[model samples]
Target: MKTFKLLSPFVLLLILIVSCSSVSEPESAVNELQVSNSLTEVEVDSIASTLSLFPNGTQFSIAFISDTAVSFYGAHRIDDDLKNTDNHDRVFEIGSISKVLTSTLLAHAIHDSIIREDQTVRSALDIEMAGDPEFTFLQLANHTSGLPRLPGGYTLNFLWNMNNPYKNFDAQELKTYLKDDLIMPRDPGETHRYSNLGAGLLGLFLSELENSSYENLLQKKIFEPMDMSRSTTDREVIKDYLVTGLTKRGSSAKNWDMADLAGAGGVLSTAEDLSRFIQANFNPDDPVLSLQRDSTFQVNDSMDIAMGWFILNRDSGDRWYWHNGGTGGYRSSVVMDPEQKTGVVVLSNISAGHSEADKIDRLSFDLMKMHFAN
Candidate 1:
């Protein structure tokens, strides 16, 4: 069993000593955390006050990142007190947001000529099994692969364990499930159907193509170039910096283990690293990011699914690309306008079951909209 390192008290003192601050400001977010000068003090207080409403032990890292400016905020609750946290580099599980990164890997593959978007899973895998699944790489990235949300017979396994549901289901097991129990519910790309199984399969195919594990591929292809040095899918590599996720009751929750389904929801990252990723989206010259952002499968008049993002068409003829994710003990939301070269990232240690979890997404969307308005 993995044991999470607790850093609350000692780390707090260390931050105090390092920052050269004597005491925490009372009752609000003006403590150890740093906010950039790009935002006015009034704007900072409003963001802080709104984030303070969550339950105790909830740590949040948020950023307003753009080509021209970067603003950040971090706060956490301890008992009845809300203290500003270091916004620069505290790692937390990003949940299904990993799908966005996984899809970027696919785009990277396409950029490298290792594969094409139209390639079917059957041909890619060299599997001649019956039923002949026709899901393609493009469909997997956009969640229209006609695959179920999860593999059959495993959704309810969380009844047995929740925090780390995928702990035992590894790659070999997934292969067995694909061969023995897999069934396509609809024809590939017939319609949009969000599927963790499909994304995981896409990750597996990418890994197989490179003869590498998913984590290794992410490092070589995505994280390193993007300078997301602290983000990773392997939990053990981040155990020291990993914040112990909190349950709804304000108690510690076990971290998740993705096993073979790491692609579905497994990466741990910090606000600083994630902001850099948003900056990369501002770069129109990067072929991989360009491809990921441009190839959209229209879901409706108001929305479209890109390689790993949802494009929300605003009434004002502008659009925002966004995605949100949650796991047993964490929730994340990110929204960005590449045209404006601005985005917001919200990461919290509060569980998805927490009553106030919706605030994370609300804050992200509202901040993005507000930036565009200004």
Candidate 2:
């Protein structure tokens, strides 16, 4: 979760603009851009202006969702290094942002009476554990499970394939690590250290509870229900609509395959699909979404961890729920203010490891902050 004191919107925007580093100048890129004609000139100008901040070969998509209107603006630096129209349906790997979906799956399990939020991993998986590790599903989703970011020997396993690190670590390997190499460095539910391993394990546990694959559960529980047709854990399914990812050094990169670790960072989705999911977060009538959005762990005065969302406390008392994603070649961000019914999602083919990757996060936050500024 991103942490900072809320300064006045004007001052904050000024600081963001001044302090931010930029992507190196793209190779002979021109200023040509495409804005959605549906947006008013001011809206188009305001939204499209940010496209200039991205890298040379960037395909940037922005979706602004509000109570009164929804607007999507997309642009790509084409073969000639001139900007042109992109599409909101173009899919990108939304890295740890997949944790939000994983957490929501946990919320759904509890909602359906399949498991209690406090159910232990050992109880769920029926495993005997060492070191008295008794972390609950809630702890896993909220990043307080004391699980390491990666499983034992994961570094050596993924060392050979940095671009597709989690591809080879299938369910059996994860199971083997859990049984033979499990270790807990911190007591469960005591602290909030981010843990990809914990989130992935929760996804695996849900598979045990539902007797289905994590990919199937997501389709059944989320994407299918929300009509996110372009969203899936299967990269093959999205290959046609998928945007090619770029490495930090601005070279072509491979899309990551999470295999069994799909819960941690496997989901791939588009702006149009994600807007539906974000809109659901604002629906008070939806019990599962309501449960997912509730605060489960207080990370600090400024931030609260919800099921799959991080609640950023604003000075105005309304909260902004957000999550950002990064894979080898792609970066994504989603943020919303339920009170004002406004939010932003930014999906870029730029590598999150890129020096300017935080620009995506800042762009989303700055756009969302503008809504509250009113």
Candidate 3:
């Protein structure tokens, strides 16, 4: 969808049009994509070489991990500003990757018996829906909930403040939209259409069910348990360590505040912590974790919907469950093979155009393909 095209390109552009600074010289950085035949890195140098090409100096962190081992890399710096370099610990807005975490929360609620899989939107929240009343929580989690990608009134605010459209879209406004402006356009569970409103509303409903804030619920259920100490939904927490994202023209780009839509694309994280999050998905003790990856709906021949992940059928039937996120200036990606217990996490400060951002996404898949090929 064009909405996805505009927002979900997570990280560096592959094309040469944008100029960025290299954090370190190629020779000094780990420029190799291949580590071995079974888990070789492909075009790693090519990826590393483009590091400096980001006009605002890209700050990125990547990790490749399997059941047996892990490899990590980080480049944190401002373009052409050697004196102002940071490290992997610096935080970046993770954009929509927050969805995966929200889904994880949904899984936890199901696991804890706080919410039922059969619960419908009309019963869960204050929404006055005009469509199928039987639209279940399962449908919402898998994005089969017939809701539009955005609330009906979102377009005007988006046009008025492209940089920070959601800044004014707080909890009260979201409730207003749900009660007054919602109109179901498709039959629930008919097809897979991504909906930020649906996902964010799910978070809100879950939060109310738990009698706590979304951030607090996540902290108790996932972040603290997994030791993702640096991750947070509150912008104030990561403010000191946040990287400054840049625009196409190399000007400072505005960071977004998601207001009520925080569940959709509002969280800050680091690569190291995300790697741990992915690794935890393979832990057998975590039954709820697997629920997030369980197939919920079919999207197409190559893709399916799992709680919040896009399940791609790749490499002779291996499933690549992943999600990507982007806001005004930042983009992020996370992909993993639950079967292989292998995954990659990339976070960048620049939101290059779609083609470049897509290249960054492809590079992650390439990393996995190398492993599967062997």
Candidate 4:
């Protein structure tokens, strides 16, 4: 009986070991996809199913990439009369994502010894201002500038005729606003507030410093070097692939001309091109959009606002750097995990439907955990 009891315990131990091994073997054998080709059919299906939970008429293109690999998915409502052509290369206006590009260009300018972050805005531009002379370029780029979200005295007529009210305001007008009637929203650098006007002003300052058009500078410094062939500040380059812009709530789509605010929300891009850019950001050796610094700027504890990238901290303790864009009818997002060297870029033509960008962002994090969690 004693021998039998000992034998039974040993048998049970062996069985448990075998069972655990059996359970874990497949998971161990299942390789996690790299940045180059991480999203498989199963992954894509999962993402599509999650996205379908949103409303109809919504369109989105997503790309996931790791250090050396990439995978993508493109989806839209079937009943919506929209067609996906060159879906990978289809150019859509990336709204705030332009800020990321702009910030990258500014960083390049600093690398080339063109401008310094601590330099005052007055040093870069000859514009007059009514606010304090203490406002610096860093303040403007980081949204620490006390400048209002929009320049003072802007009228609806400006928006109607200009399509973008701030676009038509020239350096002379900006000077007037500063010199005659600028109002400080808050003390400079006291808090973080997003200001489209502040970013636009930085673009204007760069243009003035270079003594060239913003479009020309962006092409020569960023687009050409990065091989962003389809990315363009010029409307002419993307005119062919331009999807009509839509209102946030209405059916009628309008063409938003960035003639005035071109620097802030002007550049048009595709998922394929943006993915390449994001990869370059992760690995700066590519000679495209490189990260010159070891660390980017963090906004308190919530997000890291790098030169052009925003880092989001997940509940699972994972860090993701991302940015979203929305023009009239176009919406897009770019998310990346520098640690795993994995990232995702999503673009959409219709803006009124769902927060697909945010959804894709969370999904990217979840997928990373699913495939890579140890």
Could you give the C-alpha RMSD of every candidate to the true structure, in order shown? 8.6, 10.4, 9.3, 13.1
> Backbone collision count in every prediction?
0, 0, 15, 14
| TM-score winner, 1 or 4 | 1
Which sections of candidate 2 miss by over 4 Å?
Answer: 1-54, 79-82, 153-160
lDDT of 1 by residue, 2-69 (tens): 22222333233112111111111121221233433254444444555555665678887877775644
Weakest 10 consecutive residues of candidate 2 by summed lDDT: 14-23
Count residue pairs with overlapping backbones in model 2. Answer: 0
* lDDT for each residue of candidate 2 in 1-374, tens digit (9 for 90 to 100): 22212222222121000011101121111112222114343343344455444455777777776544455667665442424454678888889889999988888889889888788877877755566598999998889999888886666766577788888778788877777888887899889988889898888888977899998999888887777888998888878998889887668888888888889999999887787677666556567777888899999999999887889998879899999999889888999987666778889888877887887787788767664355
* TM-score of each model, in listed order: 0.87, 0.85, 0.83, 0.77
Question: Between prediction 2 and prediction 4, which has the larger TM-score?
Answer: 2
Q: Of the pair 2 and 3, which is ahead by lDDT?
A: 2
Q: Where in model 3 is the C-alpha error above 4 Å?
A: 1-42, 49-53, 76-86, 126-134, 352-355, 371-373
Worst 10 residues of 3 by lDDT: 15-24
Report every candidate's CA lDDT: 0.75, 0.75, 0.70, 0.61
1 against 2, candidate with superior TM-score: 1
Task: Look at candidate 1 and tell me the lDDT of residue 235.
Answer: 74
Candidate 4 regions off by >4 Å? 1-42, 49-57, 80-86, 153-167, 170-172, 249-252, 284-298, 315-317, 352-374
For model 4, how does the per-residue alpha-carbon lDDT over 263-292 read when each residue is reduced to its tens digit?
677788877777666655554343224443
